[model samples]
Target: MDLHKPPAGPPAQPPVPASAQPPARTPEGCLVVAIRLPVRIVVLVLVLPVRMAWDALVVAGRFLGDAVLGPLGRALSWLAKALLLWPLIGLWRYVVVPVGKALGWLGHVLLVVPVVWSYRQVLTPLGYGLAWLARGAWAGLAWVYACVLTPAGHAVRWLLKGIGTVLAVVGAGAYTAVAWLVRFLIVVPARWIHAAVLVPTGRAVAWCARGVWRLLALLVTGIGVVLYWTVRILVVLPALALWRWVLAPVGRFLAVLAREVGEALGHAWRIAGRISSAVGRLLGTLFRWIFVEPVRWVYRTVLTPVGHAVRDAVLRPAARAARSVGRAARQALAAARETARQTRADLRRMLFGESLPREAVGRREPSAGETRTLGRSTTALTKD
Candidate 1:
């Protein structure tokens, strides 16, 4: 076998879909077809006007949204931004931001700087001095404990050990006497009563209880068997018989009726749509012919020439007269402005009198006749 070649026997077939497979045709009766035709006809008659009205309402709503609501919504949004949002944004940017920054700087200077300075200059040195004093006190305590308290504690411990030994011998004797008295007075009597009386009584009571429990259990089992049979005969059998003979058949018939009605409604709706569309097209064509065509003809043939004549005969001369008047007015305004300007100049000159002439200043660069070269220096260091 070659490694590169695929090992195959027969080519695989593609699976067929369940929907694409041929359906088993059932026989349809003549009565069903007759009934279906009248039902669909009635449904279509009822649905046609409704479909046309629905389509009209949809068109009207779309027109209203486009022509009225859309621009209104945009204007409202722009007005809100201009009246409310822009001022708030300006206040936040120009007023609030600067105030907040100043507050932050003030807080740092008033609170944080003092806290940091106190911690570094006052508290830190104080803590160190206190820590040094604590260390010295701790050293003195350690010295007292090692030199004075340790020896005193050893002496007390020795004294306590001797006293404890004497008490231990006395306590042992008293404990032995107490044990002897308790055994005879309490423990022996309790053991005897438990073994001799309680054991026999408990056994007799338990045996009687078991017998009563068994009798009750048998009685309960018999009652349960009778109730089970009674319920099966009275309730379960009748319910099962009713479901099998009456209810199931009624449910199947109703399901078949509902399915047929649904299919008929769908078929009627599609036919109604086509009828409504044709009616709408006819009405639209009639409207265009009756109204729009006449208006367009009048505009093209009669009104256009009349409008052009009016523009040429009356409007043109009026516009020319308006332009001439505007030009004359502008010239008069300019002459007035010149008169005012000259009057102001005369008044200023009369008040101040003639101005003094300014003096000439010398040039910083060398003059043409005094040009310096390599042979002659201009600096004081190499003056010639």
Candidate 2:
């Protein structure tokens, strides 16, 4: 399968650009136009200096980051790797790894193996013995519960039931006697006192209380009526008039002024941004003409030519000489290596004589008779 092959489909068309898709614009009023112009003019005047200052700060920050901070950060990173990272890596790899492996092996042999052996040989059998003893104890408990405790529990329950019945009968007789005595001695006397003496006294007291309450209600009503009119004339009416005639109108006017000021500030800031951009471009052009252009011209016309001449006249010849020396050194080293290999081979042959050559065997195909079947064994144990 050829994975690099393109799909058999039509190429996609390019998307429409944002400039080609213009948005709808709403119409504005004369008031907005009048406000916008003056607001924008004032805002532009105010914001231009701030925008320029901000741009200057941004440029300075970028220059510092590129020219100073980037190189410093890279140098620090390299120093940290050399001083801290490399040594730690070497220690972990060479020292810690070997020691950890040795400790692990020792733990497995001296501690883990013995613990595992003890658990299997000693603890496992002990647990089984304990389990067997527990089973015997449980059976004894079950027998005792069934034979002795169950009957004893039944006898206790019956005895408690008989005692409870007798107590209930006695409690019922005592309750009836107490209820009879309370009704005659206490309840009858309280009922007579309430009917004969309390009833008339209560009725007289209630009549007096009603008359006092009526008198008090009339006085309170008269005072409340006077207070209502007095408060209405002195405080409530004046407050309402102030709110309607003065405060509400003032608040509405203030709100309108605030809205206009907010709108003016917004328009002014946008205009200021455009003005600042134009000023920045003008300054940048002037700077390029005054300083950058001359420097660029000098570098291109004079320095470039001088540098080319120096490279051709001095550096090229030196580089050629260095290359020649390097080539000669490499050739000499290669010749020395070849001589050493030849010397070692000659000495080995002198000491051990020439090695014997092996005979080459021809390849052959197996016959039908030599091919083993499922019923016949071809292994060494049953070979023919």
Candidate 3:
């Protein structure tokens, strides 16, 4: 054997002759072969209408997207560009750029150069001179304050202080003299008058007032006593006798009569109240027997049973039926979603000329346990 080549095994067997090979056999049973024609017929009949409708929808969708919507979108885009872009380009080129350049040139000439020149030549010198003047003026003012005005201000302040001290001393002494004179002339005299003349006059006047008050009190007392005896003799004794003899007996009789009447009236009021109470209770009993009790009977005997029957026989089953319908709709929607996902995968493969990438969908079929659980749930729903 060569170094690069592997060692050979036993020699290959010769090809089998065609006549010696057994023929392939068909696996179909008798029943399947017998029913095959009917199955094919039924399948074809079902598929024909679906195929026609699919072809029509595909053609219509393709025409709308490729012919109508494509041209309309392109034309609208072109019109939008024509409306929006051209005017902006023209304005920038013909108006805005030129105007901006002109304004820039004018500003450079009129504003920028003048400002630079004035700052360098005019404002610089003027500001320096004004600064110098301000410095000189400040120096002058400092000299006036420190060397000339300060000592003069001190001397003037000393003179003014001396004058203020003199005025204060004179004012204090004058105030003291005037105060002493006021005490002698006004306060002393007023005190003497109050102590000597006013006190004695007030005491004499108070004594005379007391005497007059006592005299008036005695006169009033004498008059009151005289009036009391006169009224008793002339009026009070006669009135008392008349009341004792005439008015007292009449008042007693009237009071007794009023008390009797009050007692009778009270007794009649209580009797009337009792009768009214009895009548009210009787009417209330009658009303209950006639109306409210019958209403309660109908509700308890008729309406309640009907409501229970309706709920048990009609509403509960109806609710279960609605729940079953909802469950069926959800199952159908899930099936449709899975079908749509498969269709999308097929479309992706067709459109992209690519092999299928995901084996997850193929592997995602429910397990046997899950299928049994689903069947059990479906059976339960049906039974319900």
Q: Can you give the lDDT of residue 302 in candidate 3?
A: 97
Give the Cα-based TM-score of candidate 3 against the true structure: 0.28
Pick by TM-score: which candidate is best? 1
Residue pairs with colliding backbones in model 1 are: none
Residue lDDT tens for model 1, 3-51: 7977778989899999999998778767556667777777778878888
- Superior candidate under TM-score, 1 versus 2: 1
lDDT of each: 0.91, 0.89, 0.82
Q: Write candidate 2's Cα lDDT for 1-384 as tens digits.
A: 777977699889899899997896667657656666675567667777777788778889999999999999999999999999999999999999999999999999999999999999999999999999999999999999999999999999999999999999999999999999999999999999999999999999999999999999999999999999999999999999999999998897676556667877777667666777888799999999999999999999999999999999999999999999999999999999999999999999999998789897743533567776899776666767
Q: Write the per-residue lDDT of candidate 3 for residues 1-384, one digit (tens) a residue.
A: 567976789998999999999997657556545545554555455555555455557767988999999999999998988998888899999999999999999999999999999999999999999999999999999998999999999999999999999999999999999999999999999999999999999999999999999999999999999999999999999999999998998887666555545544455445545655566578779999999899999999999999999999999999999999999999999999999999999999888888757655533444566554544553444543
True lDDT of residue 313, candidate 2: 97
Clashes of each: 0, 0, 0
Model 2 spans with C-alpha error above 4 angstroms: 1-41, 69-115, 139-169, 197-225, 309-384
What are the clashing pairs of model 2?
Answer: none
